[model samples]
Target: MKVGIADTTFARYDMASDAIDELKKRVSVDIARYTVPGIKDLPVASKKLIEEEDVDIVMAFGMPGPEDIDKRCADQASNGIINAQLMTNTHIVEVFVHEDEAEEKNLPEVAEGRARSHARNVIKLIKSPKKLIKDAGKGKREGYPDLGSIRR
Candidate 1:
């Protein structure tokens, strides 16, 4: 199977690299990479990867600044991604990290962890979707601490 990675130049970190490393460690698949100027461009890049590159899945990464406009752009980008997924009937896992989500010193770590985690999920999504069902309500999180399920 082929996986597409659509990343933005605006991102503070190279999330695709971490995701690629993680994916390489876990599975063998072809990767189609496309880079654009910013988050708003990810949807089209992802769509092209699927429609033209013939990738089975896509990982879309973006990092918006901590401004209101940035948040709005992210939301719009997310909606476009959803529309692209519907149009292509493919899964485009959106991985967005806000510029202010972590301290400057920790941003890279946060981005890397998130990318790696999502890479695993991508594997599960294509290879064994049942595993996701089994993980339901487990409070699993990518790039951050997993909030374990609450129990009495």
Candidate 2:
């Protein structure tokens, strides 16, 4: 299988590279990599990886700023990825690290851990998606403490 990485040119590019390295330990897969200027550009880069490079799956990684607009832009990028996945019949795993996901002191650690975990997730998703099916609705950031179950 092939996994493409669509990464942004920001302070967190290392996180994506870290993900790639972490992924390699579990699976033997071909990698195609692309770097966009920023988070907003990730979708198009990911689309090209699928449509042009013919990768089986894509890992889109970005770090949005600590602002409302940045979050909104991340949402847009995510939506575009979803659309591309539907249109092309592929999976584009969205891995984003917001500036506020952790305390300022813990941001670096959380970001690295989250990216690594998500990379492993990308591999599992491609290999045996059923194993992860039950957690489809259990949305939580990868590197954070488990928040436990929510009750309505």
Candidate 3:
């Protein structure tokens, strides 16, 4: 199996590094990495990876700043990613960490943990999607602790 990693240079942390490490530990797959200048470029980068690299899935990582403008950009970028998914009929796991999600001292840990957890999800998505379905309503999160299902 092959995996595509699209990361942005503007990110405060190198999330792709953690993701690659986790992927290496969990599965044996070819990794195709594409680096872009900012989060908004991720959609094209991810699509290119899917088309040119022939990866089965993509992991798009970005860190938006703690600003309203940044949030808007993130939202637009996310929509573009969704459009890319529909255009290609492929799954692009969007992993975005906002700078304000945690205190400055804890930001790295939060970002890394999020990347690693999402990496695991990526593996499950390809190898065993049933595993994910089994956890429906479980409120699984990437950086933070999972929130158990409220359903009875």
Global local distance difference test of model 2: 0.85
lDDT of each: 0.95, 0.85, 0.95
Give candidate 3's whole-model lDDT: 0.95
- Best-fitting candidate, scored by TM-score: 3
lDDT of 2 by residue, 70-140 (tens): 88998998898888888888899888888877677888888888889898888888999887877765755
Over the stretch 56-150, how does candidate 3's per-residue lDDT look in tens digits?
Answer: 99999999999999999999999999999999999999999999989999999999999999999999999999998888988888899999889
The TM-score values for the models, in the order shown, are: 0.97, 0.89, 0.98
Ranking by TM-score: 3, 1, 2
Ranking by lDDT: 3, 1, 2
TM-score of model 3 relative to the true fold?
0.98
Model 1 has how many clashing residue pairs? 1
Show the colliding residue pairs in model 2: none
What are the C-alpha RMSDs, in order, of all predicted structures? Answer: 0.9, 2.0, 0.8
